[model samples]
Target chain A: MKRIAYPAAIQALIGELKRLPGIGPRSAERIALWMLQSRDARPLEVSRVIREVQESIHACPRCGFFTTDTLCEICADTTRDAAQICVVEQPTDILPLERTGVFLGRYHALGGRISPLDHVGPEELRIDALIERIKAEAPSEIILALGSDVEGEATANYLATLLRELPVTVTRLAQGLPAGGGLEQADELTLSRALAGRTAVKG
Target chain B: MKRIAYPAAIQALIGELKRLPGIGPRSAERIALWMLQSRDARPLEVSRVIREVQESIHACPRCGFFTTDTLCEICADTTRDAAQICVVEQPTDILPLERTGVFLGRYHALGGRISPLDHVGPEELRIDALIERIKAEAPSEIILALGSDVEGEATANYLATLLRELPVTVTRLAQGLPAGGGLEQADELTLSRALAGRTAVKG
Candidate 1:
């Protein structure tokens, strides 16, 4: 007997859905079916919104953050502290730091960290742009907010060396146990980092 | 401090993405970001495919399956056995049964089962069309290949009662330990059903 196959349009839609970050074959099929069969216009709304975003949004030239104009919101805002610039690997990383409400400074997205295995070097990142920004804007501090992984460390170290000749103080985010995380869940590296970075009690 | 929020377009896109089945806030944000930042034209392709599917695909008028034409492929095919009509809850359910390579008959999708709690009645489903088909085509057997859940059982029993006076025989898929499933994993209800429906040895 000849095998039954999904129509070409449906198969194509499923293939597209599977390219999403976490969606697999079964999830793609389910999503495709839902989009086709759902009573509401949500799927169409998604398509419209995607087009709207694509047409309007672009990366900020100065900071590498998503923007609709000449500069991103952070870069454009006059009230944000220009003396301190927090650096991160990607634009997505800025949101969490903003949510914390601790950092009132502006941000600079590096696009990605330097990874030798992935063939990404300093030249591939926004390092030159960052150096230019430091020279022009004269921020007192450059806080490295990259991850604690090997690539993150290498990138931070490399940035610190590059910025050494400049008049800015380079700092990195402390490596330690996460807030609300229990000691029992801490790995050996995390425990050692916590111990090494311990601060004196205020009392 | 003023709270930082995503731009209006990005937020709208995230909201739309979250409406998809199984996608939550984080997943929606990730997908929205990926769509905005991906180097390839995949996101635009998805938008185009969605529009294409919406414009072309419609439920088959006769069988309620997805089709771009007058009737679904299964319904259009003349070689399929007209004597046996398999009934399913949704059009999506037919694919798995088709993949099993056992059933070669035409299918009737009920669209959904009779669920009083959800206010879905027989009138809301394709029961009338099924009965009409039975009277017009006079198939030999009607197989209820629905899930073994409460709603499925209620629907199957209701259909059997409704079709009692008809010339066709009513049957359902067997309830037992699944193929490749161990007896130890079988629940009490499944075990009881397996025992009650045991077939005689062929030796």
Candidate 2:
């Protein structure tokens, strides 16, 4: 069916909006129309912000998290434990860990995991930078906070072997039943891990 | 707990993105980060389109649908039925009716309905413009294709009473059980409307 052709600019706006993750054609249209018609709508403000982010925001050279500064805020802070580094798959993952207040150390974004099907290897990631940081800082421990997927496991194993010569303790996030998870709802692998890694209750 | 401070531009982008319907803080962050980091992401293109839409698109002089031209495409089209105009609460509604291929007539967007709580009265809508168009064009029929809500009913009734003086047939979209709707799932009012509005299946 031939589409009801919106104005050239409206159509262009819709097409551009649809490029965002999870935004489909209907959602794109709704957003475009809302931006155009609503009295209180601030399309200009949105546009300005988009342009500013494009011009200013970039990956931190040292840690790979987003920042407009020469060095990201986390990297610039002297209070964080420089002797421990947490490795993650993407820069976005840093927030949830930070919110938990569990790790007071620095971060290293791998950019991606080793996915053979997608032709992504360690060379494509920030592994070399991580190694350089490890060598320079000589961190006491390196926490692999990557996902539990097959690719994450492969990348972790590869990194472990490569860093064997370095004088640092290597560890991974524990695999078991997640917090607030039910035994009945837990998958077989998680159940088995929980059983194998169980600890005695304290008095 | 204190939030991880994103760059001024990045935080501003996320906040602006959250203004769009259905986009929350988490989704906003995800989209902003994706725009900043992804190799194929087109923040510039999106920014350009938004600016163009904001600068160019406006209400068409004749029919009130959005257009960059002096007149909307539908109003400019010489082939459409000039004697029949479909009245809608908003410009966005015109597309779905056009997609059905059931209405080849032009459209008149009222811009809004009469909502007392929101302080929107008949004066706020394009009712006067609609009346003027009806007088000038002498349309044979005016179809009210507003929503099935209370405001829609009130607006339709008000329009119908006001249009009683004119020599034209005024009708509304039929309300009944929707296409492919099941009797078990339909509400009481819908079932009753369907029963009352029933017609014999044609051969």
Candidate number of the best TM-score: 1
Q: For model 2, which pairs clash?
A: none
Worst 10 residues of 2 chain B by lDDT: B1-10
How well is each residue in A57-89 modelled by candidate 1, as lDDT tens digits?
A: 998898888888899888888899999999999
The segments of candidate 2 whose C-alpha lies over 4 angstroms from its true place after superposition are A1-3, A195-203, B1-3, B182-184, B191-203
Per-residue CA lDDT of candidate 1, range B1-203, in tens?
Answer: 47777888899999988888888898989999898779788888988898788878899988888899999999999999999999999998989989999999999999999999999999999999999999998999999988899999999999999999999999999999999999999999999999999999999
Roughly what TM-score does model 2 have, to 2 decimal places?
Answer: 0.91
Per-model lDDT:
0.91, 0.89
DockQ of candidate 2 compared with the true complex: 0.59
TM-score of chain B of each: 0.96, 0.94
- Name the lDDT value of residue B152 in candidate 1: 96
Worst 10 residues of 2 chain A by lDDT: A1-10
Candidate 1: list runs displaced more than 4 Å. A180-185, A191-203, B182-184
